[model samples]
Structures are given as C-alpha cells and as structure tokens.
Target: MSEAVPLPAGTTLGKSFEYGIDINLGTSAVPEWQPFRRISGFQPTFTPTTQDAQTYDDLGADNSDVTGWSFAIAFNVQVNRNTATGLYLPEIEALLARTRPSAKGEAAVVEVRWYHKPEIGTPNPADAGQGRATVAITRQNTGPNGEIEVLSVTLSGKGPYTEIANPFDGWDSTVAVIGTVGPEGAGDGDLVTITGTGFLGTTGVSIDGASLAATDYTVVSGATIIAALPAGDAGNVPVIVTNAAGASAPHTFTRGA
Candidate 1:
C-alpha cells in the first residue's frame, strides 16, 4: 500500500486579484504610492534577452547566455473619476501628465511597484518588485451607445526590477493596529470600544485568540470598532484585530470578574 503524503498546514490557493500594482506619482524623495485601480486584464511580462553561445563544441545542442531582461505591464482602465474628490484616478492623471509635450527627459518616466497581496498575512519583503517605467496610453474606440470610455495603458520597464517591501503594508488602511479598548476591564458580553488605526476593513475581532462572531462586532470607522467581549478567563487577555492585510499584534486587555 502507498503511504499518504501530508500537506503543509494553512495552505491556500491564491486568487487572480491577489496581485497589486502601484505607481509613485510623487518624486523619489517623497513617494506617494497611488494604487492603479479600476484596471482589467492586468498582465505583466518579463522577458530575458539572451545571446546565442553555441560553439563548435556543441555540435547539435543549442546554448545561450542571458544578457539582460525587460519587464512590462499592460492593463485596461475604464474612464472615471472620484465623485467626491472630482479628480481623475491618480494613475490616470500621472500617465496623462507624463504624456504632455512639455514633459521632457525625467518627467516622462514613472516609478512603479508590484507585489503579491497575501490574503491574510503580513507583507513579505521578497514578494514585491519596483522599478521605473515609461508609459504608453492608447484610447480604445468608443462603443456604440452607452459603454464607458476605456484606455489601454502599458508600462515598459526602463531597467531591472529590484525586490523591496510592500509600500502599502504600512498604510493606515492596510495594517491593523489596536490602540486602546475602552473600559479595559469589561467582562464577557460587554461592549467595548476599540480605537486604533487600520480598522477600515476589519474582518474579525478576538479576545485571547477566541474570535467573536461577525454580529458581535461593528466597525465604526477606520480607527474604531465596537465589539462585545467573548468569554475568557478572569484576567488579562490579548485582543487582536484582523483584516484582509493581516492580524494586528495582540493588545493586552483585562477581564473583570
């Protein structure tokens, strides 16, 4: 009989949308990572430039040496702007601004970064790549009647991409942090206010590793969450907040008798 193989715990299949791309509209000195949003059919290609190294020694086989590499990303974006801000998407604005006639040498280049967005873990430094790229925009034909306008944008990498940390990992809306839970000694079934940044898309709240039901918690704002405490021992227990990005570090909270 064949033996059964054990798979690693917590293994998960990644989704197509688990990748993220961001462009820095600001300068290198002061970078502002604006997400490339509303994009469809996101495709990134990396090709290696190779030189044939076949010599007399290799009579039939072929050999080549990798000389260089090129990277580029192509995607389509629907024409739209923020309703409240009344401004086009940052990425669209950046690309259009760079295409202007007055945009000379350096102004024509854009800094870009891409990374694998883990569903429930902290950012891994090795999972991201960043580099400079020149933009090419082609406006697609307007559809017959009511279709929205669309633009195809391509970013041709200027040089090699360097691995780096995910820029969005430190953003307030991405990394959940527990600042304070009011009524520190509240017992089970008692409502406690959780004040912290990065609570915008909170997914779960837990006390000492015991997760509270979704109905037991309400995310009031990006910096606050109202949740009833779960049953725990009468003592200090760690409170954690989790979001799509990852779970926050445990914050010690006391439970009243």
Candidate 2:
C-alpha cells in the first residue's frame, strides 16, 4: 500500500479508463484467471428481477416484488500493431478462443477489477472491488483516424449476480508462483533455489512426491527457499510446498534426462 495523496477541495478527477484494470475469466470447474491488458474503456450496469403481486380484483392492493439481480459490463480492448505480438492481445485471444463446441472447451465467468490510480501507484481504499460475469464480443470498430484499433466487449451475468467484495479482505488463499528455479533442468544431487512468497516457516517441500529431508532445504525468508532435487528418474515432476497455512498449488519442475 502506498501513501494516499490528499485531494484538493472542489476538485473532480475523471476516472481514467486507459489502464489500472484487470479481468479474470475461466470455466466453472477450473478458473484460469488472467488480468486483461491494453484496455481503453469500461461501463457497468445492474438490473434487478421483479415480480407482480397484485390480485386482479384488488386495485388498492397493487404491489410488486423485487427478488434478485444481475449485471453487465461493457468495455473496449486495444490491439497493438507490430511484427510480433505486443503486451496483451495474445492473452485475450487465449480466453476468448476457449469457446469451443467440445465439453473440454467453453467460455465462463469473468472477474473484472479497476484501479483509479496508476497501477504502480500506492494502493487506495477503492482498489479492490470486482465483478464477475460471462462475456460476449459485441462489436469491433477501428478507432477514428488518429485513435488505436479496439474491440468492444460486453460481459453479462444472470440468475443472482453476486455483490462485489474486496478481494484483499480476509483473503487467506496462499498463491505461490515459481518465479524461477536455478538449474531449471538439473539432475539428482543438484541444489536449486526457488523464489516466491508466503513461505515463512515452511514445514516440508517435495519433488515428484519424494519428500526432501530437513537438511535438504532451508527457508530463506517469506519469499524464498533452497532445496536439493532428490535422486530420481529424468522427467517433469510437481514441486509442492506445505506450511502451517496449508499446501500451495503444485508447480512443475523439469528434471534433466
């Protein structure tokens, strides 16, 4: 969290839709969450479910019921021009491309978040609210002469869209990512350094289900650990970390052949 700057009196700053936003989307069973990049515009709407309660004979008993709600968000996605792909188009395509006929591939809910300040700026109180919904590509229009190319994406949700929650509040899930493992394809008797977070007081670590002895690993800090690869067959194996908090999602480590 960064220090908050005071806003001047009577000053109104328009929200900048250029950056500081993320969109997470995946299936109902497994969510391959990813943040959106190169976004240009965003608009969200909410709709409520209603039901009639008035009887035909009772005009004075006129009534209606509001039972549930839903929501939608519309936004513009930008495409970069270059010999190679830019920062975002490829990732966006990966998600949208999942809408296939087979059961193995299909579109699912998307989680969207917006940060009013620059992404690198200190975190503010308004930085954590998010919405989730199924998305649809509404239109594609090349911007006016001087503007960048863009795609209009609209996401909608039905049957009880949930209320936005502060993702950082009471967030207990341990999200550990293997940023790098030196000697990436090392063999037995080789030592490796794994760098990541939420590693304080690590209880155990394993490679391919073979537990490494205490002497084999050292908890360098809350963000790092050093361990030796157990002697085993050459192949790819999962690396698991366990602590008082819980086990982290398995990360793949390839062993030398």
Candidate 3:
C-alpha cells in the first residue's frame, strides 16, 4: 500500500485481490451488551407555572476500561409544554454526609429516562430512587368528573438540600374500605355496610367504642372501612376507620352474627 501518490512503475506484479467482503457501518457508542446505571442528580418541576421546568445535573463514572461493574449518570433534561400528564416520581433524595473514604457502601437506584416531544421529541422516563428518596413525584390527570389534576413534578437532585424545596406531602391514597358483614349471628344494631378508609367527610360510625347514630355507611378509598354488624360476639372485633386524616387502626373482622 506504498503511500497514496504514484504507483505505476512496472504495471505487473502478479496477483491483487480482496475476496469475500461486505461493509455497512454507523456506530459511536452505547453497545457492549448494554447494561449500565448511576444517576445522582435531577430536578425538574412544573405544576402550573405556565409550564417551564429545566436545568439538570448528573453524575456517574466507573468503566474500569470495559467492565468490572459500572455505575453511571449523565443528565440534561427539562421538558416544557406546560408539562403534566401523570407519574413523575424523582425521589432518590440523596442523604450523603457521605464521605466514602474508599468503598463500603452503595445506594443504587440508577435509572433516568426523560422524553418529551416538542421537537426531536420522544424521551419518556420518570423514576429515580431505589435506595430511598422521599419518592416525590405526581402530575396525574385523566378526564371527566372532579377532573383529576397533577402536572409536572420531579425532585431529587441530591441533598442536604439546604432547602430549594424539601418535604414531600401528598395525601389522597387511603386504600382500604370494604363492607359485607350482616345478618348471621348478629349482636348490636345489625344493618351492615360501613366500608371505611379516609372515608371523605364520613360524619359517623362506632362499633366497639359505641358512637353510632346510624347512616348505613358507604366509603370506598381513604383505605376502606365498612361497618354494620354492631351487636358483636364472635371474637376479633376492633373496627376503627375515620377520616379528615385521622382514625384507622382496628381493622379486624370476625363477628358475623
């Protein structure tokens, strides 16, 4: 292959051939069996501020040349189109007075995916925290009746966050309000159906504590607590389910008659 310039001396060597070949290429990086993660920062927020939440940061480095076990994080995300469609939990709220001298502790939940179509669009991933972060995230909505709302929520970019914002507070998940205990061995009032769990504005019902002016009962999802068998006597009866963010700790039922 003598330098690429002049080559026509004798014009007769003998044989020159490059047999059996096919070519097609286009690759820079991100393919070695693909399996890597290490995200230590990310903070995106927008809950009705005319949609605009940007400024990102990331961290992660451990290649050992090729593979010895690697963790990685690289970030730059902020999608704004008034961002809000539900499920944006980024609570790996780092608590690192962390002085990892060399190595002996690791909190891993490295997963970052951000996709929002607004041009060159298509990047959707909202989940950060597997080792523990207040698990902060919520921007949910789904059409009609009371019209659910939550649009734009992402917070977990490592802290001692002296306080840009810290303290994840959200209550609307009381899960447990079921009813079906009537006319069998009956003890108190016997008119059953007091399913309760954060029973939204549920004015009254009391079994073993005895305070029932009586209303029939039907509350389904402040975490359910349905009652209607107050003539008690079968064993295991401690029923307590109230709301306004209060009573919920006596959910045991076994008094059928």
Candidate 4:
C-alpha cells in the first residue's frame, strides 16, 4: 500500500470474472479481502503419482525478504490403466521461484489421490485364485519298513500364472509331497502314472513324504507330462505337482507288493 485511495461509495472492487469497476491504478492503499479474478486458463501440467516419487519444495526470502507462503494450483490429471497397481502425480511445479528460494512455504502433506482406472469388464482370474485346498493321504510303501524320501514337484496352469503357494510346510507325511507307486490293486513293481499339467518339469519326486529323484520323464505338452515310477517303499501316496510357479492339486497313486 502506497497512499490512501478512495472509490465511489457504491463501487465494487476485487470481484473479477463476476463483476468489478476496472480501476486501473498505479498504487493503492486498501485491504485485498476478496478475489480479484476468477481462476481460469493454462494450469500446470502434472503427472499422476504411481509407484513413482513425487515431491516439491518452494520458498523465498528477502526481509528485504517477504514472509513464507505456499501456493496451490489445481488441474485435471489422467489415471493409469492399472488403477490398483501404482501411484501417479498428475500436476507438478517447481516449489520455489528460482529468483527467491529462501522464503518458507509449508504444506502439511501431499494430498493423496486414487483415480479410478479404466473399468475392466472382466476380472483377472488370478484375483479369484489362491483358494484353500484339502489334501488326503491314501497309502505309502516302505522298501525295508523304513520311510522314503521326497525330492521335488512340478506344476502347470490354464493361463498366464500370477501367483502360487505351497501349503506343505514340511511335516513329513503331510508337509512332504507323496508319490504314487501304481493304480489300485497293482503290486509295488507295477508302473503307475501321475497325471496332471506341469508334470514334465518335475526334476524330483516324493513318496510318503520323502523327496526322491526321478528316473525318466517326458513332457507331453506345455501342460502334460509323464514321469517314470521312482524307486521307493511300495504304496499309494498323494502326489503334489509343482514348479517355479508353484504346486498343483494333489493326486494319488497306489503302490503295493
């Protein structure tokens, strides 16, 4: 404010975009208590935060430094295709004017935003996966009445795999993967095939909770596989298929002498 100023008693001041007496002034002494202009025009370009860093610091000093004040500008921002996957920053600006960086401007915290992604009509199957499973043990054959070992598992899926979990934490009979000796009514020497997707990649086998290496195997397709019977105690044991992706539904085979 430089000097006293006066306007007609009925004069409207500060109101812009709505109403105002256009008072072109070189200097003025008055209170700026109202909006001078309706905010419009080119807003700052910003990125929506998404798994990305976002921060801005702006300040200036001059007492020959004015006190600190924060400026807020708003605009519309775009959202990512995967809404739940990340964070995005739609608008950004240099926090401080380069000419005056010493002044202080404080913001409590960056306002977080969760813009909705494009509506996906069909949901990803993976969202419905990871269901609880039940496993049952049928039988296990011992070579000399001693327990057998379980080596590894293989797996396959219907579509692109996202996640897999192994429930067996390693309790010998329950935690370990069980292998099959043969179908029901087959003697221990009879060959029994363990069927399922992702069986070919099985580098090892398990029987009655013991980890054992495979003898011979074949990859029938990207999905199907056939593996030779592993040497172990003769019996039927639940078989678990597994791979890097994860384990498969538990199956069973019969082994007897």
Candidate 5:
C-alpha cells in the first residue's frame, strides 16, 4: 500500500468571484473610486499585439514578437433603481450617461481601477491595475417570466494600463491607535514599546516631524511596535505612525525630563 501525502497548509483554490472593479468618478488629482455593484461574470482580457518575426533563416516554425498590449473588462449587472429615490446605481448611471451620443471624446472616457480581493486573515496586499476606458452598455434578453433585467457593460481600454497599489485595501480602516508608550518620558536611543491597534503594516514612525530610520522600528504585530526614540525637543512631542493607507493621528509622547 502507498502512503498518503498530506496537502500543504494554507493551500486554497482562487475563486472567480474574488475580483473587484471600480470606476473613478472624480479627476486624476482627486479620485473617488466607486465599486460596481450587483455585477457578475467579470472578465478581463489582456491581448498582445504581435509582429511576424520569422524570417528566411527559420525553416517552418511560426514565431512572432509581442509589440504592444491591450486591456478590456466585461461584466453584467442587474438593473437596479431605487423607486423612492428615483435613482439608478451610481455605476449604472455613469455607464449610461457616458454612452450617450452627446458624450464625446474625454467626456466618454472614464478612469478605472480593478483589483484581486485579498483573502481574510491574511496581510497580503492586493494586486491592482489602473487606466482609462470607455463604457459600452448592452441590454440582455429578459428570461421567461421571472428573470430580472440585466445590462452587460464592457470597458474598452483607451490607453495603456498600469499596475498600482490597491487603493481600496482595507488599510484605511486599520489606522494605528496609540494606546500608550512605556516609559512616558524617554529621550534619544531609548527603546520604547508602543501598544496600539492596527500597527501591522507600519511604514514610518515620526516624532515631532522627524522620521525614524527604517531599521529603528520593528512592527511585531498588528497591535505592537518597538521603536527607538529619535532625538527631539524636551516636551510633549507628537508621535505619528504612517502606513500604506495614510498617517495616523499624532499621539503625544513625553520627551526628555
């Protein structure tokens, strides 16, 4: 009899539904990302433009060189309208408004961002992409009797897509809360343990506007950080923690005697 091998821990298959798409309703300088709701069958395609590379030297092998890339995403959403509010879903409204004949050139183009949803209880960052795309909406056939109305929306890439940090990564709600720092009064080179919540991905620690060296701080967990105090004025200085999301509110830390 053959011995059975055990599967590795944390092994799980990726689900097709574990992806999200967002449309930017605001400008590049001030982006407001609104997720597409009630969507299904989200599909993204990256097609490469290739050029014939096979020459007289090659006998019968077919070969080509990739020249460029193109991206597009398609998804279907159930038509939803709030009767009381007399409003359609933001994403649906945006799509319908942009596809109008009056909407031309830049007016028809919208910024888009998409990401792979991160797994629960894991600190893994989301893989994301950003670019501009034009929306196309098509009405789907109504099913026999009970099927709800649906619209298929396709986003055609207007230009090149670029990879970026997931803007919707749950870090915004994980702002570090400074509960307390041991040794209320400490000076330069003093090791201080910071007790707080949401300190997992701390990027920088600053005291009185002076940032600590990267090697001076260690994020032990989501609720603890050990850092060497940087030299600062002798007073109640503000200590702030910054992460991928943003900067946390400054917590007063007594410095010196």
Candidate 6:
C-alpha cells in the first residue's frame, strides 16, 4: 500500500467570525494549546493614548503624540459537551485557575493566540499570529442567548501584542497595520486609533488621497497613532500611514455621514 499523501484542499480564507482562539494555561499537562469550542465571534480592540498638542495659535485640531497603546479581545465560546473531557470544563477550569489571585494577590498571565487562519491545513505565518499576554479577565458571563450556555470572555493585554515577523519580510523598512479598534465607522471629527508596527516618525496619515493635518493626528509611538477622521463623504476610504521607513499597506476606514 502507498503512504497517504497530503493534497491541497483549495480552501478560502475565512473571516474573523469563522476563526477561533487557542489559549496556553501554564499548569496544563498538555503543553499544546486547547482550542475554544463553538466560537461565535472574535473581536480585537486597540486603544492609543494621546494628549492634545494643539497650541493657542492653532484651531484646536487635537494634534497629539502617540504615547502608548493597549489591546483587548472579546469573544463568545459555546459550552458544548466534550465526551472525553466533559463540556469545556477544562477550559473553564483553566480560565478560573489562571485568573485566580495568588497568595500575594498578584494576577497571573494568560497567553492567547488569535489565529487569523483558523483552518488547520494552511500554514500560518508568525507575523500573522497575535501573541497577547492577558493581564486580566475583565468580564465573563453565560446564558446571553435563550437557553444555550455561551461564555463571553474579555481579555486585556498586559502590554502591546507582538506579531513576530520573518527577517525577509522587510519588517524594519515596512509598515504593518495589525488591527483597528473602536467604531467600525466614524463621522467627521471622530477619533480612531491605528495599531501596528513601524509607526514612528509618521509624516502623515491619508484617507484616500487627502493627508490629515498635523493638528488632527498624533503619533503615539512606533506601534500606535490616534487620528481624527477628516471631513469626507460617507463611504469606505483607504487609510495609509507614511513615515521615513515607507508607506504601509492601506487599511479601509469607513466615514459615516
């Protein structure tokens, strides 16, 4: 008999709703990540810290510096019966155990992996992996729906989430937009944050072709920037951040009327 050979499945990349999360709870015997079951949706949030740099002579456009950033993820995982391990109890146990206060009342760190490509057959690049050190579990609740038990968990990042990139990816010279948080669509004068890497010394952030004024945006750091969406027609526009390194790949920002 011939050995079984792997074949390409020709599967399409799925959306965030289709993806799932894997968590590493240090005490577990299995070093392997335990996958969360029946994930309805996974959402990431990025908030940038900025203070108004507007001067008296300026129009008070809210120009600011990118001081720092924080990240969090919110998602729902269903409570399904696992015949072998019993109804996601292990996950619940891990969650409870890791989040419990210690003798000194110190919180534990929970590592999470938000896999962009949830499909097991495809290879996930390190850069695509979102590594978060969860410092706290802000909220958890069950029974949001009619009768089904669903766990809604929110994990706050201990620090800025890191996406390890390959050396050949030109990580040093390129801008990478990892995610955007807050409102999916904003109106004119609304503030939104662009989170990623290589954001230091950003010269400008453009929506479509129009560059935002200096007073309208702030470079929080090399990893974050808070920019107020400029006045524009309601629709989806390409957002590009340019610096001495180079211009980053465009991410869409919708401006509502």
lDDT of 4 by residue, 1-257 (tens): 76878777754443212211111111111111111122222121222322322334324422133233222222221222235854322221211121144423322112111111112221121211111111111123336765432111111111221122211111121222334323564553345555544442233444445543333443333234444554556565655655434565556666555
The CA lDDT at 123 in model 2 is 30
Best by TM-score: 5
Please list the C-alpha lDDT of all candidates, in the order they appear. 0.77, 0.61, 0.33, 0.30, 0.77, 0.63
Query: What global local distance difference test value does model 3 have?
Result: 0.33
Where does candidate 3 stray beyond 4 Å?
Answer: 1-94, 99-103, 106-234, 237-249, 255-257
Off by over 4 Å in 4: 1-182, 187-189, 231-235
**If ranked by TM-score, best first, what sequence of candidates would result?**
5, 1, 6, 2, 4, 3
Tens digits of per-residue lDDT, candidate 6, 115-216, equal 444434333334233455544343345355666666677887877876632111222456556366336668888998888876643556887688877557
Give candidate 2's error at residue 161 in angstroms: 3.3
lDDT of 1 at 51: 99
Residue-level lDDT of model 2, residues 139-165, one tens digit each, is 476556666667678876544544322
Looking at candidate 6, what is the lDDT of residue 199? 66
Q: For model 6, what is the error of residue 167's alpha carbon versus the real structure, in angstroms, after optimal superposition?
A: 16
- Tell me the TM-score of each prediction against the true structure: 0.61, 0.46, 0.20, 0.25, 0.66, 0.46
TM-score of 6: 0.46
TM-score of decoy 3: 0.20
Q: Give the worst 10-residue stretch by lDDT in candidate 1.
A: 164-173
Total clashes for model 1: 0
Candidate 3 lDDT for residue 131: 13
| C-alpha RMSD values across all candidates | 12.9, 12.3, 25.4, 32.8, 8.0, 20.9
Model 1 CA lDDT for position 129: 78
